[model samples]
Target: MESFSGPDATTSDDGPPPPSPRARSAEARRDAILTAAATAFVEHGYGATSVDDIAERLGVSKPTLYYHVGGKQELLGASFTLALDAYSDAVEDEAVSGVTGRERLHQVVQKYVEITTTVHGRCLHRVPDVELTPEVRDRLRAVKRKVDARIRDLLREGVRDGSLRSADIRMSTFAISGAMNSIAQWYAPSGKLSPEEIAERLWDSFAEGLRPR
Candidate 1:
């Protein structure tokens, strides 16, 4: 019978071990900081929120917060990007479902509204500003343009299928996007109408003129 010399006897040399529990805990702390920063930014707006405020919200030291994020601007950028990603995912998911062009368009719009009224939505609109560095501004603009292009593509499809009327797709896209994106301003789940109701009303008003009559 062969005897094993040790655990290493059967193991080939490989890279270092996985991240330790401490490292994982650190990562979790970083995520907590980002989440806290996002909530603070949304509740108070970018101009009013400070790194110290975020750190306090997370109950962490300023140095610990800095260890995770470089500074307030980086935190803002991360928050905005997170929100944009959610919005884009909602639109893309609805768009991919096989449905009538009109139905798909309305579904996409509804999803947009739903996402924009959430915490993420509030951060996206309130974080960007003149104070952002050029890099952050460019990143924000690029994300916005991507979302716009997606809306324009859907609207063009609706027009081609005759489910929507002829209109300036560009302006129409902008209008619809702007309307839904503004939900962070006044929308509350406790408000007079539910998110679904708001979406229906918006679709009814906008599609009324566009629907084939």
Candidate 2:
């Protein structure tokens, strides 16, 4: 009986097996494509950006780009999804670790502002202009609804705990969301304030009523 286990099975305790060549290649291609798309989209709005531009940036053919992403619209949608997922993850993480309702809310907002100042933020802003298919539109709307619900939950907690003044939950949720969403429009990495600073400012303004208190 021939020994089936050879040096291949011998444990030298080097480390984990390296990724397959194909897997590494695929990952590299995917990252390159996404990076190129991000740059092109930032330089040229979604409407002006084409799949060919992405392909050119990646030094790959149009078909290669299509193999990774369906088309410009799908790419745009994917970009937006990536950005929202990052922001949502940050908020979810902070909420889970926060000690109090007010602290949770503050952390969520701060993380969100930080995300909006990233390259992902530019992709998020372009989402509105992308002509998403019905399914994509529904998915995007569902994401928005989830985020809105999270904001509402935070507000409700604050009101219940007497930290936040009572107000119309629905209206307050919308107001808070709108304020955070606008960060993408004006936030810049080189701007005067960091995300943390901005978040503190926003918290102070929202919590203290911006009056002479």
* Best candidate (score: TM-score): 2
Clashing pairs in 1: none
For candidate 2, write residues 57-168 as lDDT tens digits.
8788988877776688767767777776776676564445565566677777787777777776666765464366676567667777877887778777777776676358
What residue pairs are clashing in model 2? none
* Highest-lDDT candidate: 1
lDDT of 1 by residue, 1-213 (tens): 112244344444585545555666777776777788878877787889888898888777888877777698888777666776776677665445645567778888887777777666777775556766777677768777877887787778878887787468888887887887777788765799988888899889878866876
Candidate lDDT values, in order: 0.74, 0.71
- Model 1 residue 128 CA deviation in Å: 3.6
Tell me how far the alpha carbon of residue 114 in candidate 1 is from the true structure, in angstroms, after superposition: 2.7
lDDT of 2: 0.71
Worst 10 residues of 1 by lDDT: 1-10
Query: How does model 2 score by TM-score?
Result: 0.78
Model 2: number of backbone collisions:
0
